[model samples]
Structures are given as C-alpha cells and as structure tokens.
Target: MRAFVSMLSGILFGFGLALSGMMDPSRVRGFLDIFGDWDPTMAFVMGGAVIVMAIAWRMQKAMNKPVVCDQFSLPGTKLIDARLIGGAALFGIGWGLAGLCPGPAVASLANNLSGAAIFVAAMIAGMVIFRLTERPAQ
Candidate 1:
C-alpha cells in the first residue's frame, strides 16, 4: 500500500510539473534570464504549488498521524548551517547552468534529450561520490 501510494504521488507530481511547463529546460532557462526575455510563468507555477502546500500542511497538522504511516517522516534538523547554505548555492548554480533540477531532469528523460541523459548520469555519479566521501551522520 505504501509503495503504491508513493508511486502514485510521484506520478501526480511529475504530471503537475509537466502541466506547469517545468519539464522543458528552455522554459526554465527563460525564467532565469532576467536581463533577457524573462518569463514569469514559473513564478505562477511556484506560487500555485506553495498555496497548495500551505493548505495541505494545515490539513495534515489537523490529523494526529499520517494515514499511510504510523508516524511522520519529517526531517528533524531545523538549523540553517553553512553546509546547508553551501549545498543550496551549489544546487542553484547547477540549476542556472543546466536549466533543470533533479526532479525535472528525471522527468525529462522521456523526451530523450541527450543533455538530460548526461545530466542524470552526472547527478548519479555525484551522489555516489558524496556517499563514498562523506561519513554517515552519528
């Protein structure tokens, strides 16, 4: 049941991304090009997502526990440390350059873009490198 729900949720999220024009790297790049022909469509997409998330969060809070899980799987850490900032900066830079974040990069695989394939391969390589280099948190 949990796996089914997880897969369904992923499909829904991907569908939303596609519907919002987020699956296209060119669309995202246009949004980032503020000095050029800047596009504000992504902003509207983000705003709509934020609104939906806010409402969902409130409703989830009203519940004692999740329907699928016995307990919530929320992250415990709240502090914004240097590590977090550095990682986020790296992510933003990569997004700006590639015009595709992890979600969209994976979603765009169906489009058979060669760049997307390279990006996904590099992303997987980076993940493996990070796992091998970093020690597990105590």
Candidate 2:
C-alpha cells in the first residue's frame, strides 16, 4: 500500500513536470534568463509547490505519525554549514549550466535521452563523491 502510494505520487509529480514544461531544458533556461527573454512559467509552478508544501507541513505537524510509516522521517539539522553551502553552490552552478535539476532531469529522461542521460550520470557521480567524502553524523 505504501509502495503503491509512492508510485502514484511519483507518477503525478512526473506528469506535473511534463505538463508544466519543466521537462524542457530550453524552457528552464528561459526562466533563469532574467536579463533576456525571461519566462515566468517556472515561477508559477514553484509558487504552487510552495503553497502546497506549506499546507502539507502544517498538516504534518498536526499528525503524530505518518499514514504509512511509524514516524515521519525528516531532516534532523537546521544548521547552516560549509557543506550545505558548498553543495547548494554546486547545485546552482549545475542547474545554470544544464538548466536541468535532478528531478526534472530524471523525469525528462525519455524526452531527451542523450542529454538527460549525461546529466543523470554526472548527478550520480556527484552524489557518489559526496557520500564518499561526507563525515559520519555524530
């Protein structure tokens, strides 16, 4: 049941990405192009996501445990650290360069096979490097 729900959520998210044009690198690049032909489509998509997430967070706080889990698994730290900053900077640079973030890159794999494949490969490599270098939680 939990697996089914997870699959459904992923499918809905992928469908939203496709319908919102987030799967298109050109459209994403246009959204980032503030000084040029800037597109506001992505902004609307992000706004909607923020709103939905805000509501979800509120509901989460009201719950003692998740519907399909023993307890909610969430980030334990709220600290601002060098590792976080560096990772965020790297992510931003990659997004600017390819105009494809991890979610959309994976979701668009079928739409742009070669480009998405390269992006996913690089993304996985980065993740592996991070895992290899990261210190164990104290």
Candidate 3:
C-alpha cells in the first residue's frame, strides 16, 4: 500500500512538472534570463509551491505523527551552515548554466535529452561522493 501511494505521488509530481512547462529547459532558462526576454512564469510556479508547502508544514506540526508512515520523517535540525551555503551556490550555478534542476532533469530523462542525461549522471555521482565522504549525523 505504501509502495502504491509512493508511486502514485511520483506520477502526480512528474505530471505537474510536465504541465508547468518545467520539462522544457528553454522555459527555465528564460525564467533565469534577466536581460534577454525574461519570463516570470516559473517564479509564479515556485511561489505557488512554496505557499502550499508552508501550509502543509504548519498542518504537519499540529499532527502528532504522519498518518501514512511509521515514523516522522521531518528533518531534525534547522541551522545555517557552510555545507548548505556551498550546496546552494553549486546548485544555482548549475541551474543558471543548464536551466535544469533535479526534478526537471529526472523528467527530461524520459524525453531523451542528452544534456539531461549528463546532468542526472553527474548528480548521482555527486550524491554518491557525499554519501561516501560525509559522517553520519548524531
């Protein structure tokens, strides 16, 4: 049952990405472009997502635990650290250059985009490196 729900959630998320024009690198690039033919549609999409997430987060706080899970899966720490800053900077640079973030990059794999394939490959490599190097949190 949990597996089915997870699969359904992923399908819905992928559909939303496709419907929002996020699957197109050109649309994302246009959003990032401030000088030439800049587009703000993606900003609105992100803003909407943030708003929804904020509401969901608040609602989650009122509940003792998640209904669908055996344990609470929320992050335990809230701190501003070098690792967060560095990761954000790296992500921003890559997004500015390729105009494709993780979600859209994964979606692009189905479309047979070569750049997306490379991006996904590099992203997996980075995750593996981080896993191998980082100490497990206490």
Candidate 4:
C-alpha cells in the first residue's frame, strides 16, 4: 500500500511537471534570464505549489501522525548556517547553468530531451561523490 501510494504520487507529480511544460530546459532558462526575456510561467507554477504546501503544512500542525506513516517526519533544524548557504549557492549556480534541477531533470527523461540524460548522469555522480566524501555530522 505504501509503495503504491509513493509510485502513484510520483507519477502524478511527473504528469503535472509535463503538463506545466517544465520538461523544457529552455523554458527554465528563460525564467532565470530575468533581464533578457523572463518567463513568468514557472513563477506561477511554483507559487501554486507553495500555496498548496502552505495549506498542507498548516494541516500538518494539527495532526499527531501521518495517514501513511507512524509519525510525522518533518525537518528538525531551522538554522541558516554557512553550510546551508553554501549548498544553496552551489545549487543556484547549477540551476542557472543547466536550468534543470533533479525533479525536472528526471521528468525530462520521459521526453528524451537532448541534454537530460547527461544532466541526470552528472547529478547521480555528484550524489555518489557527496555520499562517499561527506564527513559525519558532529
């Protein structure tokens, strides 16, 4: 049941990404090119998602346990540390360059976009490198 729900949710998310034209790297790049020719479509998509998730977070505060899990698994830290900032900067650089973060990159694979495979491969390699080189949390 859990696996089914997870798979179904992923499918729905990918479908939504496809429907919103998020599978196009050029469209994402246009959004980042704010001074040149900004595409505000993704801003609307992200705004809609933020609104929905805001409501979900409010509802989560009222619940003691999740419907599909034994307990809520929310983030514990709210710290704005150097590590967090550095990670965000790195992510922004990569996003600005490739214009396809993990979610859309994976979703673009379905359409067989020209650079999607290379991007996904690099992303996986980065993850593996991080896992291998990461120091234990103190």
lDDT per residue for candidate 3 within 1-138, as digits (tens), equals 888889998999999999998888889999999899999999989998999999998999898887778868867786988878999999999888888889989988998579789999999999999999998777
Candidate 2 matches the true fold with a TM-score of 0.93
Cα lDDT of model 2 by residue, 1-138, tens digit: 899989999999999999989888889899999999999999999999999999999999999999988989998877998878988998888888898999999997978999999999999998899789988987
**TM-scores, each model vs. reference:** 0.92, 0.93, 0.88, 0.93
Q: Whole-model Cα lDDT per candidate?
A: 0.90, 0.92, 0.90, 0.89
After superposition on all CA atoms, what RMSD does each candidate show versus the true structure? 1.5, 1.4, 1.9, 1.3
Model 4, range 1-138, lDDT digits (tens) per residue?
878899999999999888887777788889889999999999998998999999999999999998788988877877898989998998898888998889989988878766899999999999999999999988
Evaluated at residue 69, the lDDT of candidate 2 is: 85
Q: Give me the runs in candidate 2 sitting further than 4 Å from their true place.
A: none
Q: Tell me the TM-score of model 4.
A: 0.93
Tens-place lDDT digits, model 1, residues 33-110 = 999999999999999989999999898889989888998877676689887899999898888888899998998898
Candidate 1 lowest-lDDT run of ten: 71-80
